[model samples]
Target: MRRSLAIGTALALAGALAFPSGAAPLFSGPTDDIGEDVELAPSSDYADLEDGELVVDLSAANPEAEGVNDDAVTGIADVFRVRYNGSQYAHVWLTHESEAVTFYAGGEPIESEATNVTLAPNESIAVGLRVDTTGETADGLLDEITVHARAADPEDVAAQGDALSFSGSTVQTRAPTETSRRFTVLGASAGETTTFDASRLALAGAAGDLTLDEVAVTSAGGSVSLAVDASGTEGARSRVAERGAEALGAVRVTVETGAVERATLRFSVPRGFFEARGVAPADLAVYREDGGELSRLDVERTGERDGRVRFAAETPGFSTFVVAADRARVRVADARLGQTTVAPGESASVTANVTNAGTAAGEQTVSVTVDGSVVAQRVVDVAAGDTANVSVPVERDDPGEYAVAVGGVDAGTLVVEAENETDAATAQSPENGSDEPVREPAGFGLRELLGLVALLALVAASLLLARRRPW
Candidate 1:
């Protein structure tokens, strides 16, 4: 019992050392076919594997011991190991059987070497089977085959009778080659993005897996692998890794450190809108998803403007878009203060609010005019991060329309008013505070002339008579 336990412990330790840790699971597929070959090898995926070794024991069922290989055996065994790559495995047996009659592999011919072996009721034997995954083959993961088997009689062979099977798995490896692949660019301008698909890569033409290294984008900002937050999927990864670089004006794609495989990729650049505002316009270059430039578009100056430009596309292969926001104008939108509204000869204050809704800001003038003449002006020093309010006072001499303007934009009329025209004094009417009687000026003068003539005649006649006598 001690010897048996020590042997089992040693086998377990050896098995543990042979396999390395931290690899994806082995035989990670459905176990469907566990036929005669299962008896040749016991495996975790025994129920799923199709090709392996198989052994049969038909002792009681076939009392004649007549079978396909002409082997009269109390037990049978098959073996499986070594899968792909250059890794090799110690001979591990694979088998299925009943202890009545038996079957064997293609090693011994009929009657030449007898396969009959004796065993006690519940006794078992360990067989060794090795396969060559030495180099690439048809299935592409295995080599040639070399297996070993032996049997010994212990007790009566008629004790055990039931179908038994076993199976296991191994690992192999392969080298990298050139191929094509599918890639995607997440950010791009609408007009500058392509809509290419996976079929365009055509990796099969390269006969192996494709790898892309040292990929760079014109707008990638000198960074590599522009997959935001390490979320690079099999479909694609950006060549430029600099933050927001994938949305820049240029990106370069190539195999910086690996092989190329043929594959198809489909992707698109993000939608973009460009606006022209303020004094200076912009000149921008646009690139397609395939890294091809379309054309340079010119944006013109629009006073106090607000608008956007949109782009869209659909292509067959992978694509990305990039936008260049070069030299665009910034502007503000707000009310323009005009002339103050006040009664004739009255003083009132004029005020205007300037709100910036653009990328740039500076001081602007608000000039107010009343009755076609400049009445007041205010110079508010505007800053990039601040809003300004301008206020000024003006004396209104007449009642008419007042005009207000800011940054060359005209704001309509402001009205000033005087008292009503219904109350007035006329020559024929006498009213309130005046007690004088109503009369025409010419008639009043005629009545006063007769009195003046009488007084003047009396004085003159006396003076004339005295002067004549003296002379």
Candidate 2:
């Protein structure tokens, strides 16, 4: 019994030394525990261990210092770490339930590939996060970053079973620092323009001097206070994104006492907004939501200066306004002729397919040319990422072969036949198998017999006169 006990003790001691300290038992069967030993811990200066979970606070974070105009901040490298204490190999990945924050791993955004890692016993990986405050007016808990561990490799087979273990961290944000301004317009009249010092209303990342001008209040003469805020709403941001546009920001203009009839407001937009969205200045537009309907306002680019572009927009009343890039590109895809042959003075048509491969609807002019001359033209409206058919009627007065083209594309030849006068007369004739009855030829009538008798009497009188003269 002593010899057997000594041998078992020696074997147990060897097995204990094989794995590192604080590692789980070796998994031997399919029913063994897989990922329950995984834990998450703060790995960087920005993160903290709270309530057994990692937390990152962005309340005092200033994005303006990073030269970013939009309200966004990126976390440091390895903000947090995911450690697996299991004995068997496991597949680990990170997921988040937030739209405002995005996590990163290994200096690259953890959208898909970077989020995944394979770990043996006592292995760990670090993660980071980026928080955007563009549409975040007030802030609280922003996101929950979750780390999932599974026994089976997701690449090899579908992750059908439940996760073995899951751990997460919370991200919190506070309201960003903002500067606001209020202007008081007393005894405002129609057709009167008022300017205010709107420089303070610009966002924290805005550079250079800012100005507001040509503010025309079309309401009745009264005193009103105009308040402007430099923040935007989440609804406006989502709507702009759905339209394939990037929202620069939103400005909220409110009337303290009563609403106005209409107003024309001009403001400065950051030049960086255009560069970041990769949109041209001409595509910039303003949108306003009224009565649950979002409508685009009449906007015009006035000028550019001091690293900012100026735009004037007409608004219905006091409300929030969203500035975005609305670009529309229209082109012709194909052209076809309705009929290749037509007679003179007959009408034919050319159809042109127009496509708008842009973010907004646009109008395109489809022109049909015959023999180097524009025979028909039409203006067609095509929706974004859609195609529309535009048909233009064409007529030919001369009989000949003409080269047909639509929207600058060669469509083919159009042949107009000469008018056949004989065929037209034959169509009207009864003898040519027409429906009308045939008429008989005209015979001797009373009028003709009377005319012949008068002629004979006159001839006899003339003969008697001549005979008397000769005798």
Candidate 3:
């Protein structure tokens, strides 16, 4: 330690001597910009520049400064060359409000061997300094710091000769590094972790003055994922605006593929966690699966074992499972709403809407199609007799009129024209309200009409006579 100090002192002195500011300064007084302005421009010229050493007088009540991390220290080293005793010389110095300080000038030497050169009145000097601190983990911590120096005749540095002045500035030291780690409370009732596959996750180190500390979890080992609401992780209560940072908080989590398949995560209530109005247990877990309840299971009084959840055994090409209590408790029939129509050059998707036609509420795996192709399919939950709609996009995939059917109901021809044409010809003509009047070949036309009248007259005369003798 002694050797290091000696080396530093020698360098500080050598640097001060080499510095060009070794000329007398035109102005040597307090500067509001660089340091505290104590004695500005002196009260008057009568205040001899020789006796005009700058002085910063503080009030009886010094303003409280921001607290800094005690473990760390920061300081500024200044090099000044000024004319004193009618000769040019250098001076390098370091100061810290409360932390340790290190100063360097030329090469390296001992403080005892270094000469203390004072400045002449109104002499200027070159100054360069650095400030640093340790242990300031949280950002925005502040501390008060001050620096002062003197300039006097080489023969009388103790007496007012050239000039003596005060210069100081406020310093705020912090270690935004470790403290930069943002945490978030990923709440969960279940003890299990939401595993984010290493291959799937693409988290790189923080950039631009930021760092990341891989979250440490008790549940699983190896590069574990960040569970925003991990069970027993972190939370926000009385505070507002900022939450979910410490629990391995990142500004955001981005998913690739434009497809979000593994996005689902599970979280359960920790002990003493508050329950919402609809929730039963003050503590519970949550899961969000497509087409299903927010979670697979919950701890609400209303969802008692009789919470028995049911699910469809198979969803055509896909299969699903249900809670043990619901396996046989419910009977589910999947009524498919398949593609019914496809216009020419047009293609339609096949999909189904599973209604819990059953007496109880349950979840099921269902299928849907987009443009005659399978695209959307998932396991969803529904209440008893309630209906859940599933509409998969149908891209004609091709251009041409096509025949299709929805729910096995045939949907005839479809026109895949950019615009549809009128189908007026397909319609039937209006009825004349007559079935050809049952014409007997028109009965030879007019003769038939006359013969019908003659026959009626003969029949009437015969009937009149027959009525008298008829049996």
Give the candidate order by descending TM-score.
2, 1, 3
Give per-residue CA lDDT, model 3, range 198-225, as digits (tens): 2111112211211121221222211111
Clash tally, candidates in order = 82, 0, 67
The candidate that wins on TM-score is 2
Q: Give the TM-score of candidate 1.
A: 0.26
TM-score, predicted candidate 3 vs. hidden true structure: 0.18
| Candidate 2 lDDT by residue in tens digits, 1-471 | 000000111111001101111112222223234434555544443444332223444334523223113455544565556566555556666554445566666566654433456555555567665665565531434223334456645553334333233322122111223444545443344444455556435532233333343355555543334556665455665665566654566666676532477788787756765666666766777777554456778778888877777788988786667766786778888887889899999988887788887677789777789888987778889888899888877878899998888888987788899868898768768777788754446876778899999999999999999989955
Worst 10 residues of 2 by lDDT: 1-10
Show model 1 residue runs off by greater than 4 Å: 1-332, 336-341, 369-386, 407-412, 418-471
- lDDT, residue 90, candidate 3: 21
Name the regions of candidate 3 deviating beyond 4 angstroms.
1-28, 32-90, 94-146, 149-248, 251-471
Error of 1 at 382 (Å): 4.1
